[model samples]
Every structure is written in structure tokens, then in C-alpha cells.
Target chain A: MIDEWYPVGLFSQLDPAGRQTALMGEPITVGRDAEGNTRVTGGNGRTLPVRLRYGHVWSSLGEPKKELFAIPEADQPGRRFVDVGVVRVRCSPLRAVENFLDVAHFPFVHTDILGAEPHTEVQNYKVEIREDVDEVWATQVKFYQPQAAKSASGGITTEYMYRVPAPTCSVLYKTCPPRPSEWDVITLFVQPLAEDLCDVWPWMALFDDTTSLTDLIHFQQTIFLQDRSILENQIPCLLPLDPGMEIPTRADLTSVAYRRWLKRHNYTYGAQLVAQ
Target chain B: MHSDTTGSWTPVALSADLPAGTVMPVQIPAGSLALWRTDSGHTAASADRCPHRGMRLSHGFVRGEALSCIYHGWSYAQAGNCLRIPAHPGLVPPETIRVVTHMVEEADGVIWVALGRPEGRPPGLEGLVPLRSLTALANIDAIAAAAGGKTSPQGIVEVASGTGTICLLLSRQDEDRTLIHVLLKGITDQAARIAAVRSTESLRRKAEDIHKKEFAQ
Candidate 1:
């Protein structure tokens, strides 16, 4: 496992004692070091180190440059360091955001409000980040016409970025898009709970408006909760247990890529991964 | 300053602010309140302290018709009576064991909690709808001073903006702060509502700055 740093939120901005519960029912607390590095405490006392980061991420491509370094192997030799934390993932690089484009499931999964074809698909295009793993996501939109002026109705186009070992992700959604031609993306890093379970958190490039941020979050949360009920109830929750049933269709390409990516990276399980 | 002001009721929040099935912490000249609205849309304000084990009731979550404490999960009804003690499911809680409740009333979108046995019902702003409630870092006096007005006989400092005049219902949260309920005139434009939100935030910042500066002196 590489100690590749995936930028989440700023260490200084987040309170050490502040605790917020995720839609996954996992409560995470964030603390900052004197040097302004973030240490997120999850479930038990499990803490993950975080560094503030932002580089030329083409909202279109979502990749930062890679650099190499070395370190010493403990008890084996002298200073044998390794290439440290550098993220090169596409925007919204997790299932939580990728599955969001599954417009058909909205009606059956979340029956209350969001339904099938809530809005028309504005665009369906893909961009590849220059990494070992390829990534993609579709963007759809529902603009409030002059008639429904009260709501901040715009479009949401999310992209999914995939990075290896770090298994880090980026979830980017821009309003009134054609996403940002330059930059401005709400980046997120998805941490795996189990093989199937994952927690998506915000990155340095945060959602711009507070109210819009809350609304988008709650909407996504409602959808995530909708997915949780079905995913948790599924018999073979994890993929490795039943790879025998690797049936595929044209639309299942993304899911296939995700499964392949998980396999290529040493599949993480239980408390062992956190110690790294 | 004597803790309780006579016949004055601070607006803990507007009726629409709490929403159905939610509980929030609010404060007044008297003390803090665990303000909540039930599933049925009725509002209630009780002492922030839970009767069982003195947990902060505001930290409790609202479910159905009852609000349950975060600690021991002691549930209480809108009337402040202990309804269910989860650990003692078989035993019904006695009527004697109950939280100290306060008189709460909602009139014309504003929800008012009495300091003692206050005057008449909360003043009827007949045509105003509640926009939202926010905590401001200023005392009622400081808010009034910032607004260049006095706390109205009805306990509010009116900040008339280009966006249909926002009435600041100031409740002294503690020593140096007040909870301001930003309200808009009913039938105002959606644009006006947006402006109201912006206007109130600016007003709060000014009032808070005044309060803090004066305190330093």
C-alpha cells in the first residue's frame, strides 16, 4: 500500500473536537496538528493523516502530477524512503457518485420524491486521467425555467476519478454546467468501509455555496440511504465472494472496471488497512 | 441584572423554523430551552436539562411524538412529561417525574416562550411569514443599539431593509448574546426573501461587532 496523500479538507479549518455523522452511520472526528496537518479519527480511535492539496486538476481530466521519493526499510537497511502522497484521480471517483447516474434506479429505489428521469441527460461524455486505471462518469441536469424561479434549480454533472493503491477518489459536481471549463470542482475522497461499503468526504475544493452544499449533500444522502438499504440487504454483499457471477452488459462496463480495479489493488479488509 | 424580566417573552424561534419533528437549543433572558416541534406540528419548550441524569435535552433526537435523550434514551412528550424510559420498558414513568416545562405559544408564524407568566399572546404580525432563525453575537440592548432603535414593547428590534423590513425578535441567549429570528412580511417577493436572508446576516454582524467592542471598553 502506498502512502499517497489524497487531499481532503484543510487541517486548520476543521476542529479537532468536531464530530459529524456520515450517512453511512459512521461518526468521524477531525483534529489538526500544530503543523496544520489533519488527523481524522474514525469508528474507534483509528486516525487517518490528511494533508491540504490542490494542483492543476483539469475539471475535465482530474489528475495532478506524480513525483517520486525513497525511504529506509525498518531494521533491514538505511533510509529507504518511498514516493509519498500524490493523488491522480478523476472527479467523483467512487460508487456513491458513479451510481448516481443510474437514473433508472431512482424510481424503484427512492420512491418518495426523486423518480426516473427527474431531468433529461444534458450530456454523456468521458475523459481519461493519465494513470494505470481509467475513470469516467455522466452528467445530467434539470434547469428551473422562468416559471419555477424560487428554487436554485441548475444542472449537476459529476465525474468519477480512479486512483490505485491509495484507492482515492474525487467526486465533482458543478452547477450550471458544462462543468467549469477552467476549474472549480467539489472534490471528494472515498474511503472504503468494507470492500463494498465506502465513505465519501469533501476535499479542499469544497462546494461553493453553503446552502447549496447542504442541499446537494442532503439530496445525495437521501439517495445514498436508499442505496444502503438494498446493498446491505443483498446476499453476496462483497464481490470476491461471488466473482463466479461476473455477468456483464454494455452499461455494466463501469462496474466491471471498478471490480477489476479493486482486485488489482491488494483488497483491503478489517482493521489491518488503517494501521498503514 | 435580575435573571428573569417581568412580563417579557423572548421569541425562541419562529413556528416554521423548528419544522415538524425537530428539536433545537434556544435561549432567552430566563434560561436555555430545549425547543421542539412534534410530528403533529405542535411546538414545546422545556428546560434544556433532562429530568433523568441531567443530560442536555437539546442533544436529544426527535422521533414521532416524543423526544429522546442522547445519553440514557429517556423519552419525553410535548407536554414535558416523561413518556418512556427505554431501559425500564415494563415500568411506566410516574407523572411526578417530569421536566420543568415552559409556556410556549406560536402566533402568526412566531413562536414565543414566556419568561414567567408573560403578557398576552405573542404579538400578531398578521401578515409576516417566518424566514429563519439564527444566533447572533449580541445582547438585546446591543442589537437595538446597532439597529438604532429600542427593543419594542413587543420585544423586537425592527430592521427595515429594502427587502420588506426584517423584524429582529431578539432573545437574550446568555450575557452578551441574543437569538435573532429573521422574519419577512407575508406575500413578499422571493427576491425579497433572499434579500431578507442577506440583510439579516449583515445586521447581525454589525450588532455583534458593536456588542463585542462595547464589552471591551
Candidate 2:
């Protein structure tokens, strides 16, 4: 977990006075150097590796074997890259990613907007851990949403593909309402301040051309704020790796697969190893 | 007051404070509880977690007679049994999918939660009526000092006021905090009630100030 890259703040919104943040419980300061490059320094006066990508500043405590994951849609033409700001929640970072991977909660947690009553069924989806890239992917996931996006006019059965390229980060590819042929890329990059605390940075690459930037940001923030209550109040405050700890239904395929992958990689940070 | 071996009850909240169809979080020696009342005025205290997903049931809403989780709308009955799962409407939740519930007794306009297998009933406050409950940043000792009285074996502190005698029902909320339910004795008029409220507020300020001084020392 220490060797992984985590987003601390959006590059465009970094404080010139140096924003104080933490990574894996270690306090760090994010500021810009004289050359206008992003600089991340640890509490012990050690300079950490900084990578400015996906409109956010990334940092790592240990040396990362691989570079940051790629989102090709970010560089595509006519795509609006939105930095949805950060929301600090008192929950395990892994739990935040697992909640993002869940589609069944749309009907309840995000009622009327993401989903509504009578359409709570989560269809069968395919979940696999790609050995080459060492990431968990769930494809062909479909859910009935009332307002799937800012530009959505009415209810639509949204098709989604979720990917967990990093331990604390998840990228969602959902059917774009305006351009059904293309997918709207939404990502949740979590910064683990402690085992039971996280700062979620939600970014989006969308094809919508009508909605204003403030409206688009508010739409995303409203959806995530609705999820914040659930994330904070979950009992145990840690992601349980033990299957017996939490019961899962057929709709929880992505969560089940994600937990298995985390256990396989020995990613126990912010994870409860045994049932309490 | 009963012996510890026979178990004891904790005054969680005033019955008037927890209205029908609402849920609130309360604490006891065992842990936290989701104190809720059904729409029909039936009250129950359950473990503050949804059995399915561990979401705090206190954050959930009460629908008709069941407490529905805000996360997935999994409703649980006041008896702690799973009543419905909105995600899978057709499936009746298994008997194993039930939250743990504690015994609750509402007496003298106060809600008491049993910690274990408590005996007898909560102590009766025969003539006094609860005015309001407030949480103080000070402990029981500081509160008693502020009121110029000592706590009785039943956790009641009596303060002689200009209008009437003020009765404080004390419950230790945490190490440094106390939950105070202020009751009035021989006071019924609106003017007396207002004076009691003002006096209680002044007592709380003094108690908190004393607590801060002790901590500083």
C-alpha cells in the first residue's frame, strides 16, 4: 500500500501556501516549487515522488514498480475534464472503492437520481482480475437509473464498466446520455489518511456539451455526498477481507472479486483480516 | 436502584424527546444503540448496525413499523427481525438476518434501556416532570458541584431554586461528559418553567468551566 500512488489534491486547485494532507497515515505537505512543478514532502522532511496526471497531483511513500494507471479518454478531443473536488469521509479507503463498485446501492443510497424504486435489480456482471496489469475489472454491468448524468433527460438503463486499477482508486465507465456511443469516464481516487479515514477526489471525463461546469460538478458532488453518510456510519470502519464477515448476494459480484484480489495481493492496510 | 448482579438500566432519553417514527443514537456501557420508535408509538433499541451491510441503523428511517436502512432499504422490525429487502423484493429475508435488540421501558416520561437482564423497574420520579435533556461537557462531579449538591444513589441531584426545587437526573455519557435530564418539582407555571430553564443553562456553563479548569490543572 505504501508503494502505491494516491491522489492528494487536484493540480489545478493546489494551494500556493502549501496544502497539508496525509498518505497512509503519514502527514505530508503538497505545494508547488519555484519551477511551478508539483512537490510533495513528507513530515520527516523527505521528498516523495510526485506525478501530475489526470488533473490531480499523485504521490507515493515508497518506490512504485509501475507508473500511474492510464485513462485514454482524458486526452481525447472535446472531452470535458472535471475536477469534482475532495470529500473527506471517516471510512476505510478500500470501503470507498468497494462502494463505488456496487450498482445495487444506486436504487437506495442515490434514490431518484442514480436509481429509484422498482428498478433495484442488479443484472449479472462479469468480474475478473487481469494478471498482466494486476487490476480488477467488472464489465457488462447494467442498472436502471432515473437521471444517469447531468445531461440526462429521463430514466435510462445505464450500462457501466468498473475498474480498480489501484488499491484505493476506482474508475467507472458508464453510458454517456448525450452520446450513447461513447462512455463517460468517472473516477474515484482515494487518499488514505488513516485506516478509517479517507479523502475522496472524484474526477470525470465526459462528452456532455450543454451543461455548465458548475452544474456538472454539483451533480457529481450531490451523488457522492449522498454516499458519504453510508460510508462514514458503516460498522467496524474497515474493509473486511473475510468472506464470512459480510454476506453477499449475486449482485455483489464486483465487491466479492475485489476483496479476493485485495487478499491475494496481501493488501491488508485498512482491511479487517478476520471477522470480529 | 438494583444491584449490578441483577443488571441496571440507563436513562437514555426523555420519552417526549424521541417522538414516533424517528430514530436517534444513544450510548450505554455495552456500546451504542439505535433508539427508535415505530409510527404506532412502539419503541425499541437495537444494535446500531444493519445486519446485511453494517450501516448504522440510527441513520436509517422508520417506515410504518420497520426501520429501513438508508443504504439498501433493508427494513428490520422493532423486534430486530429482518422484514424486507428492497433489492430483492420477492425474497423473504432469512431468520438469521436479524439485528440484536435490547429491552426498553418508558416510565415517568423517560426512556430507560436495560443493559443486561435487569430486574424490577426504573426508579420512579412520582411528581416531577421532565423539562428537557441536555448533554454537558462536564462530568457528574462537576455538575453536582455546579448545582451545589451531591448525586444520590439513584443519580438524582437536587438543587434548591428561587422558583422551586430542580431535580437533575444524571447519566454518565462518557469519561468527561454527562447527560442531564432536568425535571421540575412543585413548578408548573410558565414563568417558573422559564426560570428553571435559565438556571439549568447557567449551571451547565459553570459545570463546563469547572471541568475545563480541572483539566488545565
Candidate 3:
């Protein structure tokens, strides 16, 4: 388990006048604010004062080490740089679309599973092998209670391949957050075209209606493009995955567990960082 | 500001919006409250004021089914009784130091906080489950006016979305703002749910913008 990559830094501020800064570090751009606060410039040159929450620009992308039955699910831990103020979230081995149940790692820490009650063993599990590249699709099936979910129609799945050297450029999964149940999931994946950049190319295969793939792509990219400035300026960018070195803390349980599982299975990637 | 004006349960939050173990600031006619959940994930609404320094209780964090104040680490039970005081770890806080409590109902997957003792439980809307809630620039009147309907005696507004009926629970966010809790009529496709949410957002923008425009003029 050897990860040659390193955490660039946490994205801090994306200020107008071409000044950006990375955290635990220096300014990536010029001076942050002409006055001392972030100013976001809109089309036609209109600027709005941007006030971000503490560590928001740094800790927006969720790192998942969830408890399935109150059992730590991450055999090996994961670390991600997060930025939520802008529209797009950039993660390494990128988790394109995180669903609701990705708990642990706070922002994504402590999520509840569906079809499977808390502490109940996963039953009726179906794994469908995909043909495109090489991947497995996992569907967590369950009947909905009137109190938890209003209806059940098409089944749901959280399908993705956690191949290292950066996870599958995107995640194909259905997501809803931790609740008592009673919600539908968005099944989609992220298509990463670059290490520092990617597109939210959404999937149109799961639904019944005729939503234009072009439209979904446009919508997702439009939002993320607006978020570029803020996300790129992170500090300790993405944490380097060092398989040889073991850094264990109580908080690292979930991430460490996930990483360990990935290593056990022999996940691999190419020596190239492609530019899309 | 008691809702003797309309005896009803008000929309506090949509199911998806309020994540577990976090306290979100919510509004009622009387004032705001620290609406949060314990670590085990149970919804509780207590007076927004921390008993110690009267700081906003919503500024606190959830430990394990109890909300702890951000300032002095004063913990309170779901029923609004003082549970623990960091200053006096072993001593049980007197009952009098408790913040006022509100009756909470989780009917139809939406968490509803009763402003006062309502006559009956929250209305069981046949099929709809809570989605998410967002603050709007418009108040109840403008929302109803924009939705082409009026608020029911219970303060719920029904809207027709993409041929499906969606119910909105409207509560005052502040002086000129309203917090909307949206739920669909019944189960439809997840895409339909998204459409309903989008439609409602469009309606809210129209209504709130209109209200703002009118006020500006």
C-alpha cells in the first residue's frame, strides 16, 4: 500500500482582484481583500462580500469512516480536503457524489444506513458486476416503513470502486443522509478529468424521465466552475496516503479502516495524472 | 407573540436538512430556540437562551441526546431541564434553571414543534415525507399569495407542483422572513421530489422577490 501523492494544502480564500491563499501556508494569489474581507465578483463586475464559516474552505469535502452497525467501517482511514462555500467539492481519489448515509469524518461522519437497521446485519445484499471498466455495484435493499419512508419504487444502490492511486475518478452511488428513513437517494458519479479539476458529469441511466445529459452536465459544471477559486486554494491540499507509515489516533479509526480494506484488495492506478 | 393568533403546530425543519448531532437555529412566534439532536439522534427544541450567560443555545453542540451550551458547557435534557453543569459536574442542576420546552412531534417524517399546547397531534398527511427546509425572504402572507392559496388555520400551505400536491409548513424566520418546511403529497419518483423542491424554490424566489420589490417601491 504505497501512495506517492501528498496533501497540497487546505483551500483557504478565493478573493477577487486575483488573490487566493492556501491554508497552514501562504497566499496563492495577490492580496486577499482590498479592504480585509472576501469580495466575490459576479457577472457584469458586481461584487458581494463573502463571509465564510471557520475552517469551511478547509474542511468541506467529507472523509467517511462510518459505523454500519455501530461498527467502525473504515478498516483503513481516509483524509480529504474540503471546501463547501463554493458549489463544488474536490476530493482525492475523488468521491464525486457523496450520498446522505456517508457518516463518520463529521461532515460525513456518523451517517445511518438504510434497509439495514442500526446494528442489524446487512441482508439481501446484491452485488452486480459492471462491464465498462472493472467494478462492482452494491445495492443495500430494504422495505420502507410508513414512518421512515413515504414510498419505495425503483431500488437504490451505493455503487463505486475504491481503486487507489486516486479512487475511481467518480463515485456511482445513491445517497440520503442519516435519518429514521423516508427519503429518496440521488444515484450519480463524478467524472474527474484532471487531478486539480473535474466535471460533475451526472448519470442519466437510473431515472425514468428524459433529463438531458447535456443539461445535467451543464448544470453541474456551471455550479462547480463558480466554486473553482475557493476549492483550489486549500492548505495541506490532499493528505498523502503513506502505506509504509502508520499514524493511528482514535479519530483516525474510520479512515484507517477504509484504507486497510482498499490495500488488502490490491487497488492500483497508472503512473500518469491525465489532464482533461 | 404567542400563536393564540392561530392555534397550530408550525413547521420547524425538513427531515433531510437537520443532520444528526448538530443544533440549528429555528424560529417561533415567541422567539428562537436551539433545535438540535443528541448524539444518538433525537430531535429536541429548547429555549434558545443558555441558562448561564443567556447566550444563544443554538450556538451549542450535541453530545449524546442532550444539547450543551457553547459558553459554560451547561447541558440540558430534551424536555428543557438542566441536565449537567460543567461548573458543578456531580451536582444535579435545580429544576428552576431549565429553559422553556416545546412539545415536539415527528409525524410524516417532518419534525414539528408546537408553539403552544395544540388540541391534537400534527396532521398525518397521507403519504408525504419531509424533504428539506430553507429560509425565505417572504413572510406567510407573501408565500400564500405567491402559491395562489391561503395559509390554513394550522398555518400549512398546499401548493400544486408538477401535477402533484406538496404541503408547506410556514413559520416566521424573523420580522420579514419565513422558514418553509416542504413535504410532497405522496410517494413519487425521486426525480419528482427534486422537481417539487425546484418548483417550490422557484415559487419562493418569485414570492420573496415580489415582496421585496413591493417593499422597495
Judging by lDDT against the true structure, name the best candidate.
Answer: 2
Fnat by candidate, in order: 0.00, 0.70, 0.00
Off by over 4 Å in 2: A14-17, B1-4, B215-217
> Model 3 — interface RMS deviation?
15.9
lDDT by residue for model 3 (A44-163), tens: 344322323222211112222221111011121321112222233453233222221121111111112122222222223343434443333344533222122112233333222222
Q: Write the per-residue lDDT of candidate 3 for residues B1-217, one digit (tens) a residue.
A: 1254446677777656668888988788777777887777788889887644345678778987888765345678898888866433446677776777888777667777887677677766657767678788886778888889988876778987666788887778676888887877763789989888788889888889867866433
Q: Report the Cα lDDT for candidate 1.
A: 0.51
lDDT of 2 at A197: 95
TM-score of chain B of each: 0.86, 0.95, 0.84
lDDT tens digits by residue: candidate 2, B85-185? 77676788888888899999998899999888787788888898999999999988899989999999989999987757899999888778889999988
Candidate 2 vs candidate 3: the lDDT winner is 2
Individual DockQ of the candidates?
Answer: 0.01, 0.62, 0.01
Give lDDT: candidate 2, residue B152. Answer: 91
* Order of candidate numbers by TM-score, starting with the best: 2, 1, 3
**Of the candidates numbered 1 and 2, which has the greater TM-score value?**
2
Worst ten in a row by lDDT for model 1 chain B = B1-10
Residue ranges of candidate 3 with Cα displaced over 4 Å: A1-276, B1-7, B215-217
Error of 2 at B34 (Å): 0.6
Report every candidate's CA lDDT. 0.51, 0.90, 0.48
Candidate 2 residues A107-154, lDDT tens each?
888889999998987777899999998889999998899999989989
